[model samples]
Target: MDLDAEFKLDDDLCYLNHAAVAPWPLRSMQAVERFARENAMRGAAHYPRWMEVENTLRENLARLINAPSPRDIALVKSTSEALSFVAYGLHWEPGDEIVISDQEFPSNRIVWESLADQGVTVRVVSLDGDDCEDDLIDAFNNNTRLLAISSVQYGTGLRMNLDKLGAACKAAKVLFCVDAIQSLGALPLDVEKSQIDFTMADGHKWLLGPEGLGVFYVRPALRESLKLHEFGWHMIANRGDYRQTTWQVAPDATRFECGSPNTMGAHAFQASTELLLEIGIDKVEALVLNRVELLERELNKIQGIEILSSRDRQRQSGILTFRVAHQDSQALYRDLMSRNVICASRGGGARFSPHCYTPDAVIHTAVERLAECIS
Candidate 1:
């Protein structure tokens, strides 16, 4: 398949910020168009087909994360909403503490920190200098009720050893939660082997869908532990039985989904995920890593650039960040953007995150353009 055709980006611009918001595949665009057209022509006449699309999305997400069943998936509005579901859903006491990395995106940190008013404590673990993987495991204690971390650090693109962390969480009896926004589509994830208690990701980044929709995965055993914070008709077990005065929460992960689904997001994400499945996660991972390696080598050769991303293959992903020796990172970010080299300023430098579909010429051009701009 021609991946370039899949994205159909403008010929004049090169998008290297998949770590931020990504452009949806052409297939996704077509899907959304069809969905909109159907809605205009025949409203609820095709609701059954829409539900089927939603089911397809759940199945695709389950396969992506290696969840045993589609019933474990809960479609939510955003990563923040999903994190909130877990943070507020649980009952916490004065001394209960949650463990998290210092490098976490605010979505992961803010939710847990908000619990401070409830007499819960949030411990921020620094993952910068020391061996971060081991330190994360060591941070856990008897007071630790849960450990929330990003699968990949947003700014530095540090890929954590989820297997090791999962094992530690299992042995320590602490709940394991992963903020998978950065790594979901770029890397292969297995919730079962990783022993993750909860996981969530917005489709706008690596999944190449829109901003509003995200997926939340909760382990089967821990589902009942979280007290429901949001409630609506859709969350009821007998969703269609409106006449029945008495109601019970849905038994599966759907309980987290309180109201009407974002059918638009569902249509778009379903299309995006189908392309990822066709390309295969392993292949995508390999392609992305290769591009990142090329970027690193090119950036290293530049006179003023300093590569900020980890050199360790096991601890790296698609993000390649670098700072100019004498120029301010923000200044360089502005210069690059002004010149049409689309990127972001992150981890104290400008971050360029390309996907498997990014053309090699675009990578070479970006590096060359930076050299010229900096010089």
Candidate 2:
């Protein structure tokens, strides 16, 4: 695939915010367009084909995360919904505890914390220590029922040692869950290697797809342990057999999908997922980190710009956050937006997250635009 041709962004725009919402590649956009046209003219005549696309997406997602099978993947509305599945479905004891990092996105934190009514404790461990992974591992005791953390922190872009954490969780017999939105498309993730019991990520971010669609993975052995709170025709083993008098809940992860599928979102997300898989995650991670490195180098050259993200190679991600001496982060963000430097105001600074396809010239231009924002 011609990488440059896939992303035909505007000449004046420097898109450096893939960590938030990524613009879809041409193929993905075209897939949506084709779906729209087919819906208009052909109607449900192409329904079976659409189902195939959705199933393919599940397989692709399984491949992306190295899940045991596509049966482990559930198409979800968003990461929040998947998190809710675990939050409400589980039978929690009054004194049970869930371990999480302090820097989790609200989707990960708020859901777990909301379980306080059930007398569950949300243990927020500080990742500020020299060895953040160890800090998390140490937080786990007999009371800890689960450990939920992001594969990469949203603001500071600190990549966690998931394998080490996973191993610890397995040994401690705690459920390992990861909010993988920030790292899924840009970095390679293996649920098996990491011993993750549950994981979810939206397609809009690094996946280069639209909103309203995401992937949820639940370990097969623990599937029934999470009692389902949502029920509908689609989640049944006899799905589509509207005339049947008896029904059984799906035997696989599809049991979590309680309603009609997002067919349009599925088409586009599958296209985007296939594109990333074609490029290969290891190659994508390398290219993404290279862009971040360039951003760090260029941003450092400007006067009074202080890099806030980690410099450790293991901890580094596509995100590079920085702030100016006298400027407020939001003010700098607005200024950059006015200058057509597409970035985000986060981590108490301006965050620039470029994908694998981001050009070096765009990275340099974004840094130059930031200089203007401060100057």
Model 1 over residues 1-375: C-alpha lDDT tens digits?
A: 789889778776768999999999999999999999999999879999999999999999999999989999999999999999999888898899999998988899989999989888988889986589788888788889999999999999999989989999999999999999999999999999999999999999999888999999999998999999899999989899889999999999999999999998999999999999999999999999999999988888988778888999999998888888989999899889987889999999999999999998898888888887888
Cα deviation in Å at residue 224, candidate 2? 0.8
TM-score versus the correct structure, for each prediction = 0.98, 0.99
lDDT string for model 2 (44-93, tens) is 99899999999999999999999999999999999999999998888999
Best-matching candidate per TM-score: 2
Clashes of each: 0, 0
Error of 2 at 178 (Å): 0.5
| C-alpha lDDT (0 to 100) for residue 239 of candidate 2 | 96
Flag regions of model 2 displaced more than 4 Å. Answer: none
